[model samples]
Target: MFDPVSTPDVQALVYASFAQLRHCRYLLLRIQDPAAARRWLRQDAVMGLLKARGQLGRETAQDEALAVAFTHTGLLRLGLQEDADFPFPSAFREGMNQPDRARALADANVETWRWGDLPGEQRQDVHLLLAHFRRTPFDEQGPLSAPALQAGGLELVQSVPTCPAFIERNEDTKESRLFEPFGFRDGLTQPVLHSTAERSRRLQQRREIDREMADDSVVADGEFVLGLPNEYGDLSYAPDDARWPSAGASANAPPHFGSHGSYLVVRHIRQHVDRFEAFDAAHPPPREGAPSLTEQMVGRRKDGAPLVQQPMPPADLDGFRFRVNDAEGFQCPLGSHIRRANPRDTLGSDVRSGVANAKLHRLIRRGRVYAGECQQADHGACGHADGRRGCGKGLFFIALNADLDRQFEFVQQRWIAHPQFADLDNESDPLLGGRGEAAFSVQSPTAGTRTTGLPAFTELVGGGYFFLPGLAALRFLAETEPAPGPPAQ
Candidate 1:
């Protein structure tokens, strides 16, 4: 059993997915009145919505969780202004809709996003993101209803619910399984938090459970949380110029403003399920002894197993490393989706250094699969090109990182979208490359390289960068009085 005394003052969602609660509702909101919003944040209703890290293990199996995050505009609305004195990273300051950021992520026509408003668009300006996870079905009269939101000085921008088809329940064992719209098992591999790994280790000692079944690498606490030493033994901050507000601390003391907090990267990606399946059918395996074309592209089977030819014995699904087992890309192609996503000892000069370097760019993902009807009028029926009716499915991808530029952005730009990644020519991440006519090359030991067209299987419909403050910082934000304004222009 975990002792609740030493738990960090971080939100539960940062360390837990709340997988027991299969249902979720993503509420995008706009702050209508800053004063009223702050007042609402201080209310018991809001304070009790989500548990702290310590309170998580004490919760009942049927408990619901609500995690709140604010975008740059949301912070501004909540009275956290950006200036030299109170610094924020440029990525959060400029947001994901900027033209340069759009180019960086290979996102086309970001001005046409369905969620946040562009300069000239009529969509709502999304400021706050509330992720509500529960075991019960979505209720219209839930705490996040229009009336409740209005009481909090907020107005609903949009409500995205979890796709029912993405959840599968086994009647015999009474276990639940989650899969993305593309039929691949989702959330199989995740980085274990320092605190979580400690608890798991204790549990393992008590029950004597096999380590392979629960294999997860523990990352540096500072890699995902502020005010702690990261992999490089430095306080974590993105882009080198970002600063954490001291909050009136001594020179030797750590800053408290961003401590235990994390930056959350949220993206609404629409997956073209039918198109992907059709392309998979059209392009079968090139040779008799190879996996399917889509399997080669994804570097994993639909069951979430890696494509390594001979996986290490007694290792779990995420146990094998590319450099140690498949350095030549003969088994798992160098440019495959999973390879580019993590790389796993395949980067840097050698295996040991590559493993260490890769740890600096890791992300803790807490994404959920989303499917249903098309909400955006402009974006036609999810990802269908033939104008099909009632076809919408995608992923509500979220990642938590202390440094935005080093972790998430680096993975997206340098690894996933880079055409020359791993010395491969004109090849990007086969799954999320977003290129219309991209090609993927499969290296063969003797049969030679086989190439296939890698069309855009997913499209970025909406995205925003948010700061998920620590519980203490959230309270500070709630209680903070408005800063003195400059003289009216």
Candidate 2:
């Protein structure tokens, strides 16, 4: 029903999780031979890759069944040097966008962050990243370790297959469900790109199928892709000094180099499954509690239902808002995991402007729970072998946005890690690291505040910030010169 002639095909707008892809392989490649890799990327591998970038419909088209994305370091390896020559955004030049890497480097968080806490991520020679959403089933040893990877001039430095937390199979119906490590349905709520006619039509199709969703908020495609209007009707670049200097109509054009690209953030979080299970077992609250202490901590029950004490009416993903029913944290706590991650209107005591305020900070979340069980959690993904004991069970959290510092980094540092979130004193996100007050508070119209302390459960294993360029820009990168290595040592 979508005419590509009139409406621009959003093949360039969305790539990875924009569609409902379940399996994704994060291929972190170290450009062994930048020139040869570029050649392969341009001539050999990137042929149908562009044609396969369209939006996903209900029936699931074979064209976009698999999506590919390259990283900033990947471009650097392709021989782009100097901030001026590069088309990356400003946050990437200074390396200030990846909050996980920035915070993980602290000695204070070393124990909590583990392998990712060190400074290795400071400069990830991890040149290229290919996110493959396999449609067919395969039996490869690893997703990235397949023969296709070796065909190029690059070396397979690390291959991480998308892993599901646990598997649920019903022989009777021949059906199964993939759960996140912490026991909630993942990829339930995601932002829809409403800026372009192409994205809008696809989102409509998505809504027709997915009834548990409703929202007319016109999120600019620029927010996700380069050269689009951001929240403030501007490119949403940082101030002049921090901005990526531009050269065009003006001597210092507003750095539109990142115009058609998206800022991609990938975090490899290692969730302590055993510790969480033990803590939940030990901290069992009263049975009368609607969601129990643990459920309230997560703002949802294990069944992916919201922690509302009483059921009202059917709704979509954005159907529920904090300020309306749970203004005073009566239904959901003010500092709960969901609330902290998305304060809605309960932030800073303002109840009316919650949705409006929260919209600006929103980033498209495309995270898949990665564990060892996804292979046979049901079947193989895109013909790749599954059940390989790869990275431990955790979250392959990926965020896409235009403004890295304002969106991704802001959420990581300000909300998730903030000690004083909302009016609550010395309280960080309970589900995250709440070094101050670990109590999970559930405010009530009658019982004032019900609080329970929970320890930090997730560890920042590894993460990095990269620029996902437009298809045209990607081709340009392919044609660029080879990266200049360190002076002869």
Give the candidate number with the greatest lDDT.
1
RMSD of 2: 6.4
What's the C-alpha lDDT at position 336 in model 2?
A: 72
Q: Which stretches of candidate 1 lie over 4 Å from their true place?
A: 1-7, 59-62, 81-86, 117-124, 169-176, 198-216, 238-254, 286-289, 374-392, 434-437, 449-452, 486-489
What's model 2's lDDT at 43?
68
Q: Score candidate 2 by lDDT.
A: 0.55
What alpha-carbon RMSD in Å does predicted model 1 have with respect to the real structure? 5.4
Steric clash pairs (candidate 1): none
Alpha carbon deviation, residue 52, candidate 1 (Å): 1.3
User: How high is each candidate's TM-score?
Assistant: 0.86, 0.76
Candidate 1 TM-score versus the reference: 0.86
- How far off is residue 158 in model 2, in Å? 1.8
Tens-digit lDDT track of model 2 for 1-489 = 212222222334253342333445666766667667777677643545443234333324442333345454555556655344433455565453245446532214333332221134333445666776554333463323456456667777566676532334354673445467766655544555554354555456546543322342346556666555666676544222122334653453324444456777777777887788788787676656456666777777777677643224534334466665666776667777777776655543464455556667777776666655433543334113433223347887778877776777677667777766666777767766744566655666777654555656876656666666555445656765544466211
